[model samples]
Target: MMSRLRITEIFYSLQGEARSVGWPTVFIRLTGCPLRCSYCDTTYAFQGGEWLSLDEILRQVASYDCRHVCVTGGEPLAQKACAELLTKLCDAGYAVSLETSGALDISVADTRVSRVMDLKTPSSGEVSKNDYTNIEHLQEQDQVKFVIADRADYDWSCAQVSEHDLTSRCEVLYSPVQGKLAPRQLADWILADHLPVRMQVQMHKLLWGDKPGH
Candidate 1:
C-alpha cells in the first residue's frame, strides 16, 4: 500500500502567528508529535486522523485558491512523507512554509519552502529534543521561534540568540505561553533586555480564544 500522511485537521484561515501573520493561508495540521511542550495547545492532534495522499492534500489546499500554505503539525516531520509533501507544494507554485518543532532534520525540505522552526526553551519540557544543527540550515527566509513561559525561558532564548548570532541568520520571534506568561510581562521582558527579536501574540487566540483548528 502506498503510504499517506495522517492528518489531524485541514482548514483555511488567516495566518495567526509567525512572520506571515495576518495573511490568508491554508493550514495542514498533521497528526502526532514526539515532544510534549509544557504549554502545548494542540494535544488533540497527538492521535486520530484521516490518512491522505500527497496529491489529495494538495488538491484540498488548491481548492482554497490561496497562494500561501502552511504545513504544520503535531510535528509534521514525524511523518516520513512530509518532506515530499513540502516539495510538491513548492513545485505547484504555492508559497509554502513549514512549521516544525526544531527536533528534526530539515535539510531535505525544499529550499523554496520557508521553515519556521520552534526552538524549545527550558520551560517547554522538550528542550533536550531540539536539534541544534537545524540552526545551520536557516536562511533569511526562515525563522526561529521561542515560546517563553517564564523568565528562565526568556534568558535561555536570549543566550541562544546571541550564541547563534541568530539575528543574522533569520527572523527570531518571542511569544508568551498563553495563560502562563502574561503577554505584557513577556513584552516588558523583551523590551527590558532590548532583545533584537519580534514579540508576538497568537492573533487567533486573541481573536477566537484558542478554538480548535483556528
Candidate 2:
C-alpha cells in the first residue's frame, strides 16, 4: 500500500509568506492542527479534507508545472507521512519549503526543505506550545517567524530574538496580525530598536483577501 496523507487543499499561487514569498508556488495544505492560535487564518484546514496517496499528491503537483512548492498545514507535521512527502518533493527536484507550527518536532523534516517555523506570540494564546528545542536545529536557510498582534507580543518577540540569538542562526521574519496590529506600527517598532529581522505582510491576503488557493 502507498503512503497517504490527509490533504486540505492543493493549489497553485504566489508564495504568500516566508522566504519564498511572491514567487509562483504550489501550496499543499494538510488537514488537522494541534494548536489553536488566536489569530488563525486558515482555520478551514482544521478538519475535513480528502486523503491522497503519495503518487497522487505528487502527480497533482507536477501538473502545476511550477518549481517552488510549499507543504503547509493546519500543521502539516501533524501527519506521520508528511516527512515522507517533504522528502519526496525534494527528491523530485522542487525547491520545497514547509510551513509548520513550531509546536512540533521539526527535526523530522528533510534538510533540503526550508523550514518556515512560527513562534506563537503571547496574543496568540498558544505560545506555550512552542518547542524551543527546535531552534538549535535551524539551518542557515531556515526561517523563524513571529506573528505579532500587539505591543506585548512585539516586545516578547524581540526578547525571544535576543534570548535565542536567532539572527545568528537563521533569518528571522516579523509579521503583524492582519487587523490587530497595524503594519506601520510594527515597522516603526522594528526601526526604533533597529531589529535585524525582515518584516513581511501577507501579500496573498492583501491581493486575495482570505480567498483559499492563495
Candidate 3:
C-alpha cells in the first residue's frame, strides 16, 4: 500500500549474473541496506537517493520499453515500500525479478516476481544475517547465489547446496567475488565435486568494470 520509495537509479542494462544473464533488462535499484558484505559493489547506494512515488517509478521503467525488469538494492527489501513497488511493477506487465540479500523475510513479496536471493557466504562478513528459513519459500523460478571469495567460502557454499538440496529447490548460482577468487578456481571446484549448480560472472561488471549506474 506504500506509495513511494527511495531509489538510487533506474537504468537499462544487460541482466548481469542470473539465469536471464546477457539479456537486456531494466534495473531499478532501491536505496539502503542493513548488511554490508565484504565484496559489496554498490556502496554508493547505501545513502542519498531520490525519493519517488510508485507512479513516477513506473513511468521511468515504461520509458525503457523493456520487458525484463530487475528490482535490486543496497538491499531493496530494507525499504518497507519495496514489496508494493514490486507488485505494482508486475501489475504493469513487465517480467519482474527481485535481487535481494538473504537477510530479509521474503514472505511478503508478490508471487509474480522471480527472486534472485543471495546467500551470504563466510567471507561476506554478514553470514550470520542470512535467513536460512527463506529456503522454504523458493520456487524453481527463483535463484540462490553464493558469491565465493576463497576456498573456505566455496566449501561452505557446497555444503549449503547439499544440506538444503538447493539445486532441486531452485537454480543455484556460484560466482567468484571480483578480484578475490578467480573464475577458473571456482569452476574447477564445481567440476571436481560434480555440484549441480550454475557458474557465472557478472556480465555488467565485465562490460562496465565497477562503474555505478550501469
Best by lDDT: 2
Worst 10 residues of 2 by lDDT: 13-22
Q: Which pairs clash in the backbone of model 3?
A: none
The C-alpha RMSD in Å for every predicted model, in order, reads 1.0, 0.6, 1.0
Model 1 misplacement above 4 A: 1-3
**What is the clash count for each candidate, in the order shown?**
0, 0, 0
Which candidate model has the greater lDDT, 2 or 3? 2
The CA lDDT at 203 in model 1 is 96
lDDT of 1 by residue, 1-214 (tens): 6658999989999999898899999999999999998899999999999999988998899999999999998999999999999999999999999999989998878999999999999998999999999999999899999999998999999999999999999999999998889999998888888888999999998788879979
What digit string (tens of lDDT, one per residue) describes model 3 on residues 1-214?
5489999999998998888898899999999999989899999999999999999999999999899999998999999889998999889899989999889998778988899999999999999999999999998899999999999999899899989999899999999998998899999999998888999999888899988888
Candidate 2, residues 1-214, lDDT tens digits: the string is 7899999999999987988889999999999999999999989999999999999999999999999999998999999999999999999999999999789999999999999999999999999999999998999999999999999999999999999999999999999999899999999999999999999999999999998878
Q: Rank the candidates by TM-score, best first.
A: 2, 3, 1
Error of 2 at 102 (Å): 1.1
Model 1, TM vs. native: 0.97
TM for candidate 3 is: 0.98
Lowest summed lDDT window (length 10), candidate 1: 1-10
The global Cα lDDT (0 to 1) of model 3 is 0.92
